[model samples]
Target: MTSDVRDTAVKDAARHEARLLWAGNRGLFALLAAARHTGPIARVPKLGWVVTDPVLARRVLNDHATFTMDGEGGVGHLWTQLFGPEMAQFFGGARHAEVRTRARDLFTEDGARSLVERSQGPWYAELARRLAGGETIDVADATRVLAGRLVSDLLGLPTDRDDDAFRAVFAAGERLAGLAMGTTASTELDPEVVERAREIVAEITSGVDAAYRAAGAGTILGRCREMDLGLPLARGLATLLAIAGTETGASGTSRTVALLHDTGQQHALLRDPGLMENAVREGLRVSTPAPVIGRHVARDAEVEGQRLRAGERILLLTYLATTGVGPFDIRREYVPETRQLWFGGGRHLCLGAAVARLQITRMLETLHSTGRPYRVVSRRAARRVLVPTYASLRIETHD
Candidate 1:
């Protein structure tokens, strides 16, 4: 039994991550590979401090006064370049807290479950039916549409369009995120790239104008309007949410499905159905979809005996840090050091963590409801994108 679960056709977690990184962004792949041997906190020549330790990474994330998301290598800097300094306020200032606090109720455990059921329940039922009938399903494609659907539902976009519209929404978000691939040396975009980004953002947010005006208070667009955050900043936030919600969620969900099959843990999971939560957590941990997180040093500070000056950037190798514990195991317990570092740490922790988890959980549950394990028929990795994801993963379940 132990061997049956332990020795299976490996999906190769390391190889999968490496392939995704290499194919999606060679520059980032090279950086992470080179820095693999660095200390928990090592200062590189140009990139400054590179943290491979989850504890230190969380420390940096929690220390907003020292490290910020507003300037230089931080994600906020990218938004400010695209929108304006007003968007920067949402990243580093009190408005960050205000927005998160206001939207807090919408991301709680119950809230996440409710959101998933409201936005994606029907799709799951259909997927289960198909898989149970021994039909091959493209998990990756489904995940992309599912991610888009959830984001659309949250922003109160016109759900009137079919899944293709949301798939395009996901693609637009992908293109916008892809623009950041060349941002290793600098997060500042060239004029042409910025122009392209504007075009993409406009295309994706075409419905935002109407949603902002008519969306209810519970919706994100409506909340932005209620907060009196002008149109430009609201658009920036919407774009951020779209990309953040889609890329990571899709990657994590599909990868988790592949991981469980490759690890041959589906039978163990089948026997002890109570392990569903751990299976989801383990999947997310091993995948660590949003692998590297960047931050700009706002003020001078000494971390792990290394002095970091303001205006420098740090890259936290989140994928390596979290997965370093061991291979994918559905029975694995929560590790204190990692402590959900994949979703990120500190006040800026992903607002969609619950939503992402619920999505993956629902996918696993759908597969479990088939009353048998599934097999991966084939898989393809996504290329030239910001997030490492499966472009396609076809799986079939047996009775």
Candidate 2:
């Protein structure tokens, strides 16, 4: 086939595959099966271009020169806009490393412990109290609220109890998601949405900046300022931290609740409260919140016998990898020591993974300790389009 024909064919296949996977809940499982049996270098037209082998998954993520983080799709554009042009660490090699390193200190074990104590603990307590009040709560909504507050607090942002800031963020996310999934013509900010987004961003930025200004010399934000990272970089980092801190834990927690209620795993969890940690890990392994991650091939390389040229996109079907289709068997125990790629491989792996784990663990422990038997009311479950999430999971709790 001519190069044009080949490119067209690849694009067509990617669109089809993406639709199928998104349409069918079983796409995750299918991708894993393909990866295991096909030996990592499988063509997923649905996702466009490439899926890496297990061995190469590490190399693809780590090697910034040979593989780039910025892919051909509009998603990368949206990310750049949301995080700044220089934030394209996935595509830019050394630059990506530097940015990732600068923010690493915020997500360490000590950082996570402090975050949980100062932020997540109170949020969980509030959620527990609300649940105890006989309200039909959507766990996802609760998670979002808690995450937003925690993120805001961490960045020294003014997390007003007002709903406007939260609404603005949600609206921005919806517009961005639509743009990324090709559901919308453009993510060009609508006038109203743009205004709201700016308001929210300004509020967050000013709050964080003020905190840095007032903080003691040893504070995290204070230190970054002292190092002369500048206001823009500091603000960008704060925004990134807030969004990640809120979304990952919120989504994971809600999904875990949904899975347990759906699969009858809640009783199992209750029987062995000690199993909460394992169950959380299992849920993350099986249904990772951010299921798809991509990298760009920076240089000519051979993966699983397929010769990829520079600038080719390689999409990692992480949702599939988590399902244990090929080499993974979910029925067995998960050994974290051996299975390192769950959070991802190489330099760009999730910095906040430990924090996410702690959040999930605490949430699960609290729920299990309550000793409440809850049934998921399917009718009341709220569906989110962009992230493909459940807005609220209504649990009919029987004490």
Candidate 3:
């Protein structure tokens, strides 16, 4: 077939598969089946277009020469708008490394320690209070509030006092979620979405700008500005941080809670509180908030005897990979010394992974330590949107 015909065929198949995966529960099972039967499945005309075998996943993510994390293939345009033009370019190759390095200091162990001590504690207290009211609460929204508060604290933004700013961030998250789920057309831009996007950008920019101005002249943002990274880069980092920090945490928390309640794993963890850490890791491994990470084929590459041309998009189903879909087994613990790749394999590995772990660990600890018997009142699939996330996790505390 001609390249155009091939491309059209792949696109059509991807759309159908995306709908089934996003619209129903079968997508989850399909992922598991793909992982089990084949090392990697080149699914055409279904919900998941490609299931990256463990080996292939390792190769694609690790071999920067073969695949790039520029987010260029399918949903690149949508991310470009959300992350801004300059930020989008940085996600590609060498530029991505440069920009990622500048912001690395903020996500380091020390940085996370400071954030947890100064910020997370307060956020946790607030969440506990809200739950203490004895009313059934949406865990998803509660988690979002916690994540949002963390972002606000980190950027020195006035989120807690400013409901308008908080709402804007929440709305931007909603729009981005829609785009990620494949439910919304990338070409169709909603003016309201645009306004919300602009609001989030402005709020984040203003927060970082204020931080720069208030710093004793040698802060992180100050150093970036001095290095010629400019305000836009700062803004981009802040924006990216806000989205990544909030949504991932929110989704992970709600899903972990739901999974625990549904599987009766929460009680086990509560019985042995020290196991909370392990449970957190297992939850992440099982549900994997960011289940799908995409890459663009930088050049021609072959996997499992199939050839993929340059510029073709491939998705790494990390969540599926974790569920014993391939060679790796989730039943085994991820010892840093023994495990191959979990937080990603290559240079594009998640920068905020450490902080993310810390936040998740803390949240799980808090939940278990509460000693309140809580059960999932209702658990349902989230609305069709770009990113697949749990729509609501209603829990009722009994004791």
Candidate 4:
């Protein structure tokens, strides 16, 4: 496609994306829209500090001592309310480092590829076969099931059940994450909300106790037992896995599929299968599933000439930071300043980054398996949720 055509296509894709944001969370859509012109950093009323620059966001994320996850404005604070202060150790304590260290091998690139294939390869094959037969598939719903399956396999949750069981797994995680929708301004949750969140957490961890007891050494719960971390924290960690791995992975997968179709890049990718990796990178870069990252100002610090006092909160607008570079282009090179701000930075960088990338790549491969571009039949944006995503995106191979 010509430059003009590609630009128009990109804008069209962006408009649909904007609608998803608006439908899902109007407040976030407004913040991102306004941040475009707010320069690098700005202080917003009631929302604390907002960082739009990728470099600045990375700086704040990397400054663990100055910006923390366990205080009033951080994600850890939200978790502590539901799981209790003991759960705070998973955020900032030495236990955090130890857990990541122990779980490191499980998230490595090779490990991620193995895990995806072992847990989800058959599903992808079946999806590709269905598409080839010209059957419309709900990409959005399928992703949720696929994500749930991966999480269950990873945690040694029972896999003898059907897709509905896994969908229930994903729904429980989504409801739990939705509870945090009101936490943008403050990380503290009301007693009622905390109670509700705990109920959802219990649903997510219903199988954890059994898994922890009998899971093989290869599973995360079994590893927790080997570490003697006890059942409560193990349940907390299991719930964390459900949230961290489910919504974001499903959102990224479906959104990427929509982007490739909407932007008319499917043809380019079909012509050159070697661009598969580029397509995946560009998809995650553009979708930016975990858009806003919250950090507590642990100590006074200066960033880009602005002084951030201790106890204040800062919201890193990662979605804006990542997308500001340009529209999605499979040929786009790696960005240095932004790095992987979408996954975060420093010691807290997303442990599942590799798995997320591979999952998206695998989805794209499955769609292209028949050597034909797919067409979007219809889509509906998920509303009243923390993450902006499709509730259902129907598609089939183009005739």
Candidate 5:
């Protein structure tokens, strides 16, 4: 592609991404827009401290002693309300580290690839077959089901049903995450909201009790039982896995597809298959599914010369932090400062990071296997959801 074409492609990708955010949540889009003008760290009126610089954002994530997830303004605060105070242990207490250590192998590269192949390989095969037959497939919808299938297999849930059954799994998780739509300025939830969330939690974990009892050691619930974490915490952890693994993974997958098409980078990947890894990284970086990360101040600390006191909150504008660098390019090298900041940093870094990457890599490879670049037929942005993504992104490969 010519330099002018590359520039135009870059702008087109940004436009589509902006629309997804706008359609998903206006408040989030506004915050991200404002962050562009703010300094590296600035305090907003009701939103607490906002950090847009990649370096500062990673610093807050790594500084667990000074910033916590269990207190006000953090995601854990929202979970504790729905799951009880014991849930706090999984956020900052020793239990957090213990759980990660115990479940470490399940999330490793080899383990992740095995899980992906076992749960989703067949679906990919079907998708590839359909594309090759000149069928237009909705990549976004496929991702939801794929995410549901992967999480179900990982949790040892019954995956013996149809695609709609797995779609229901994804839907339940989406409804649960939707409850947090009102939690941007405050992590605290209304009593009624908490009640509704618990109801949804029950729906998401309807099969967990049986799974925990009989699931093999390779599954997460099985590990929970081995750790003797009890039924309540097990339920909480299960719901967490459902939400954490599905929504972000689904969003990243679909958006990566759209990003490659919108930026005209799919042809580049088709030419140089070795750029597949870089393409995946650039996709996740450009379309950061979890655009904003919130943390509660644990104690007085200085970040970028700003003194933050306990009881306050900080919002890391990860979307702006990662995208501020540049547009998505398949050939772009790894960034030093933003080293996987999209997956987050420090001890709480996403345990399913490898799983997420492998999923995207598989998706790109499937599109490439057609031996012809695919064209997006149409796409609609998901609305009023925790993660901004496409509701339907239809595509058909050229003959």
Candidate 6:
């Protein structure tokens, strides 16, 4: 790796990421920065339990009986307030397992490939053509639109709308996620904040009501309906899909592009395309899209030799947990402890992990198709948003 592009790229990526933490939610940033020096599982003064060890983080996620997703500090708590108690209970009881079991097939490797092609193939083809023709395109913008298009298609939302509509959908999802930024201190959304989130959810789920009724058996909403999950729950499910699928995918893909280029590893990927898989994995590992995972203590439990009482909350500094392995290297082997901890562990593991990986694969393939390394003409980081990603990363392949 060249010292110039590689070194500055790392600095730029860090700057953007730090800004995201500092501007979006200082409380979260403080906890994450402090967790590095603290023990594996320590009680944060106002933030409850803060767990930076990958081992303990997974322990909390796996202990559904003790560390649950309901109550005041988990993200589900915010959703429950906006949607209702029925939704909150769903996160705790048997229903979550049931839904994950039923919906499992949709995210298999083959299924993810098909879903990505159906939702985003043509766009990638277009991008490939443009780069081949010497056009510098905004890869970051393309990922956001692509992310929007994929979520809508998966949920059987209206697709007659153009890229702008999907971009709007992506932006709305970001705004919806942004409303929760203040939740670092507490997952409880203020009544007025809840109202704003409701409006955003309505915008996000506007298509879900009809899609829930008419979507085919292949779509997620249809599966919910078949399972007797009513419109409200269906809306909740769709909104979750929208948030989970969009922001993280967009963030991970674009940042990966910048990371490879900034680190001057594009040449390595170009030489041995077999490393494509490693490249994608390294990107997501370094980026760790969700960055942090939160849980609410359901009962008195012991973790890392410390006891946590019911009603307490825990924060998993996953970025630190995963990044501790090493810096970004396409040659790096998988870390045993942090096996895909970014997508999370246990029942709540991200359903779209395969799709997210495939999306980045396609984008990298498209760039590689030109048979030459692409250079970053310019890039800008997104600010005050839930995910730390480039607002614009303009690039062009060598002609």
- Minimal lDDT window, size 10, model 3: 323-332
lDDT string, candidate 3, 1-399, tens digits: 466754554354334333434553444445545545655757444332365456667776777767765544434445566556776666664666765676677778888767765666875665566567766767766666667667776665654464455645655665555544431212334566656667756754666777655543223455456556667766776666677777777666766676566545566676667676666676666556666666667788777788877866677776666645322122345644213344666776767777777777776665554587687676555555434456666776777
RMSD of 6: 1.8
- The residue ranges of model 3 lying beyond 4 angstroms of the native Cα positions read 1-49, 74-85, 93-95, 129-135, 159-167, 183-223, 325-332, 335-342, 379-381
Question: Which prediction has the highest lDDT against the true structure?
Answer: 5
RMSD of each: 1.5, 9.2, 9.2, 1.0, 0.8, 1.8
lDDT of each: 0.87, 0.58, 0.60, 0.90, 0.91, 0.86
Clashing pairs in 4: none
Candidate 1: worst 10 consecutive residues by lDDT? 4-13
Q: What is the lDDT of residue 285 in candidate 1?
A: 92
Question: What's the TM-score of each model vs. the native?
Answer: 0.97, 0.76, 0.76, 0.98, 0.99, 0.96
Per residue, candidate 2 scores C-alpha lDDT tens digits across 1-399 of 466754554354334334433542344435544565654566555454445344456666677567655545323434556556655544354644665566676678887777776766776776667667665655666666667666665565555666556545544444333334431223334455545545555655656768767644434466567666667666666655655566556667766666665555577677767676677777676556666666656678887678877755677656555554322122347654325455776666777788788877777765654578676664232333334445556664666
Model 6, 59: alpha-carbon shift in Å?
A: 1.1
Question: Whose lDDT is higher: candidate 1's or candidate 2's?
Answer: 1
**Poorly placed runs, candidate 2 (over 4 Å):** 1-39, 44-47, 52-55, 70-78, 81-85, 88-105, 132-135, 160-171, 183-223, 325-331, 335-342, 378-384
- Write the residue-wise lDDT of candidate 5 on 246-282 in tens digits: 9999999999999999988898889888999998899
Q: Write the per-residue lDDT of candidate 1 for residues 1-399, one digit (tens) a residue.
A: 566435544545557667877888888888878877887989887676789988889999999888988888898899998998888887878888888888888889998888899889999999999987878999999998988999999999977679898899999999999999887667888999999999999998898999999999888888889998878877888999999999999999998888888777788888998998899899889888888889999889999899888899988889878978888888888899999999998999999898998899899889878788888898888999888889999989875
Error of 6 at 367 (Å): 1.3
Model 4 compared with the native: what TM-score? 0.98
Clashes of each: 0, 14, 13, 0, 0, 0
Measured on C-alpha atoms, candidate 1 has an lDDT of 0.87
In the range 263-321, model 6's lDDT, one tens digit per residue, is 77888899999999999999998888888888988789888689889899998989898
